[model samples]
Target: MSNDNCTSNVSQSIIGVLDVIAPQIAKANGLLFWGVILVGVVVGIGTYAPRYRRHPLIGILFVAATTHFLPIISSVAASVTSTELLIHTILINDGLNSRVYCTQYAHIFLIFVWAGLVMMVAVNASVIVVGDARERRNIGPLKAVTGAVVWTTYLTISTLVDLYREKVATIQFIEQRTVANVTVLGQLFLIMYTKLIFKYYAFYKAKHSFAHGRSPSLVDGYMDQLQQLGDNSDTPTILKQGEYTEYDARLHPPALIVMGEDNAQVDNQPYGNRLKWIPGQGDKVLTLDRVWKLDDMDMLQSPSAQPKYLVFSFTLFKLLRCRFAKYTISSASFTKTQKFFRYTLIKGSGAAGERAFRIVVDELSFLHDYYNSSKPIYYSHHGFVIFNIILSLYTIGYCIYLMVIYIVLMAMGYHHSQIYCSDECLGEIFEADFAGKYSDYVQRPPSPVPCDTHADLIDGSKCTSYTILTWHIATTVFEVQQNQQQHDKCPHNVAATHLSRYCAYLVACYPELLTDNNDEWCKRLYEDAKKEAARVLSTPRGATATYPLIVDLLSTQSTHSVLKDGASLGKQLVDSGMGWEPLARFWSEMILYVAPSENLEAQAEAVARGGELITLIWAMLSHAGIDRK
Candidate 1:
């Protein structure tokens, strides 16, 4: 009986200890309940606010406002609940002087709340700052007011919860209710945080996927039209029949002589522009269809006219790989703060602005190439590889850093900026060729000619005539003609000839794509070239004239005097040893770069019009990493 009594006394002592600790646990649960509500409100605001509309970072700012108020709202509720719980405990404890009292658990729970509050503040502040940078706007006042409210509420709630714990009586009823509240709060926090993380991850993954798949189409419909034109005729007409007239027929009597003028009937067969139907013994006539030969015509017509996929050389692939790797590494090395500055403040403009800038730079570069064929040092294949590697690595690192920052901020109740640069932005750069110094964010080498520098010397009229002259020179450069053949052999002449004509085609049909601000100049140039071509065609024995002889005649005639006067720019290039080969390569590359850089919105609007050769080249350049912004 004595042992049983001792055991009963021990049990009573344990029960007494529990009674003392029960009130503290209940107060801690109340604090936890408010914490859970804070988390729920923050998550809810962040998730829905960013999706409210599509205007840069406006939605993100809205999120910041809502999240900034989370602590204030939670703290006010906590204070009121603490007071109610304290009064209830005192009334239920039989007025036994059982007052509310602060405990170790209450301090620890307040620490958690304060820590959570600080985290939320940090998150909201970061979102606001970054969003402002990205959108080029300021909403600091909103952030400040919200932050003040949160801090005030937190201090007030802390005092009330502390007071409630210090005065409330320890009781079984309060303990059970508090425990249930804590359990529910913990579960809700887990669910909400998980959802927030998943949403951000999915968004980042989608952007990455889109960037990887943004290769442009390398071939278009223009090549097919050229091919059809080539296939219908075995021998291209070097000059129209009207170019040769029967003025006196004194220059070449052997060729111009006819057996009978009545039977020939001017031979208007239309089959051969240079061929003439001369009366033979009977009504038959011998047609000289292959008299004047343009060697480059055969080469130009040999290639397939349809659009084709780009096939990069092994060297090109290695160069591009190195560039991409370098960009990734450099980007990875950026500090969190640096990344925030870059993505937020530096690259704040949306994708549309970035693309527009790219188009302007590309158009400028295209015009520059028409007058200047000197390639930049960085344009070499080796330099291209190294440069791109550095750029790509930096981009990669920056992207990764951004992802981390986004995740952290979102977890802390800040919403991500919705107006991120997309694959379309990258696509514009790739299609546009190298970036220019005028770009706000991208650092590029200074152009030899500034984008705004108007080359008045390179009007459309001069460029068109120069192109025609270049084509003529390229075609007959290696011909076997006895009197006109030069000893110098240039393998690139054929390529130069084809590209020259193509440039002329672009100048005539798509002048706006090259220079939106100089449409009048292009139109004047086309009309002048057309008139000059007609004049050349009407000259006596013009059909039989060699390219060099034509150049000599053009040089003397005031109508085509630009060729000799240096206004055409071809004489300068020729004197500098940038013969047809180098000039052709430069123009070809320039044309290709400019085609896709034409305002993509404009191109999309005219999708039914037809494709351009420049588009094909743009795609090839993109595939090769040569045109990356």
Candidate 2:
């Protein structure tokens, strides 16, 4: 009887204490619940706003912080309401027992919050995928959708399980279970959120470092090593002081430097003009102090060995670790975890390694563009073209096949006339130049044949019937003359000259890539031109020569002379009153049409070795939609 009385007294004392504490706990929880809601709304707006979205790290942190807070708030509210019910049973109902209420309200509230979070995740994922696609990034839509769906399903399942546990469990069991589960989940949330925070912090550091004009620590170190390597290398430069490198300079004789000519203009010339000799530029010529050699091309092409630690990879690995190993003791494995933590905190985030990688990539891209723009003369690698071929195989193959068909048709006596100029005088010149041995190369098809005609010219027969090669040379010579006559620079002439010379280079070096007949004709023309040049040089009058003098000597040569074809062609063009501007435009258009579009691999290979004129033409043709597959 005394033991029972002591137990009753102890129980009554516990009830009295609970009665005092329960109301205070409810009041505090009510404040906390409203506080969490207020904080969540503010954080949501702050995170999702456009201004905050730009700083992804801040946005991620806000989301993670809110997520962690919500679970704790729910747990507290459950405890508060349960204690209130117990107090009502003991005090208001006048019962000797206190009953714990099921945490159904808290479970429902959590489910709703998680549902909203799932939707937010889906929306964010969609936005990211669409945004990346709009920017031409290779983000697979299906992969993004799958990832979103899986994450959403997982969250939904967890929420549903919490709700089920509240419904089926006893009040005492539910209270104990909810507290333990919430505690574990909150800890897991913190670990996961902390990992994400660090990952984004790395990204933040990388981007900020770059924006501030400082190389990321990782990139700076790598660059230092690269500079050291370059300094230690024994590679020779292409051009020393006082040496001039001309455009297509390898094929031609060293330029004759005329005395007493103004040389000041040469030094201020642009990059393109630096490779060619100005017609009137005197003894002081354009020279390179230092130039990239063919060996440099190899070095440029070689990939850098710098470590690339992306924030995305870090985040992904952390997430996987949390998902698979969160409950396992192995998640805290000593050596590997310590190493990873040290590496990420020190080597990875120390200087924004990902940003450094991106910087390297961007610099490499700029170097590529520069290399392409300058047009390299030689290539050291044979397989360089393979990359281009693989990228545009069908387009390249179709272009090659079309070229072959056109060549075959031309060889079989089918001819196409020039479309722009329908001048009768030009026709007469073409007829006279190709009249004898080259008659087969220039044949006039019957009436109603396709030909380019001026709007004002009613007669199609007035269009010239010269081969494409003849038109190329005539326009090139005319453009060169016009460029010399004008003091101001003509961009069209510059383009025409470079393209024409590149075409000539192709004919001389890679004849098999062109039509067989045209290749032979170009070879014959080059040989004849060399002989005529030698003959003209032998004459005392030709000792001091200009391009015009050379043209005159070639034009006046007899029909039986080796340069008779070029002579007649040059004379006819000179006699025509049409200025060089129209001719320059004609050659520019003609080269675009005539340049071999086949084998982008070959062109890319050329570009990798240096820049390639063929690659430029190919790119232009693509832009103009002239060579669609």
Pairs with steric clashes in candidate 2: 375-611, 376-610, 376-611, 385-601, 419-452
Each model's lDDT comes to 0.35, 0.35
Among these predictions, the greatest lDDT belongs to: 2
- Give the poorly placed runs of model 1, Cα more than 4 Å off: 1-483, 486-491, 541-543, 560-580, 605-607, 619-629
TM-score of each: 0.25, 0.25
Cα RMSD to the true fold for all candidates: 29.8, 33.5
Candidate 2 C-alpha error for residue 537, in Å: 4.1
Compose the digit string of candidate 2's lDDT tens values, residues 1-629: 24344344444644554445445454544544543453444334332332333357756754554454444444544553343222112222222333222123333333333333333332222211111111121111222223333443455346546555545333443445556445434433333333233323332332222111111221222222223333222312211222324322221211111111122232222211122224433224311111111233343554342222222222222222221212211222222222332343224463654543343233333323322221111111223234324423543453465467448646844333110111111121111111111111112232341221100000112211123334444544455465566646566656655555555555445443343335566555545545545676567756764548656655564232334444445446666857556656755665555454554434433443443444454443332224524
Which portions of model 2 show Cα errors greater than 4 Å?
1-489, 492-496, 512-525, 545-552, 556-562, 619-625
Error of 2 at 354 (Å): 30
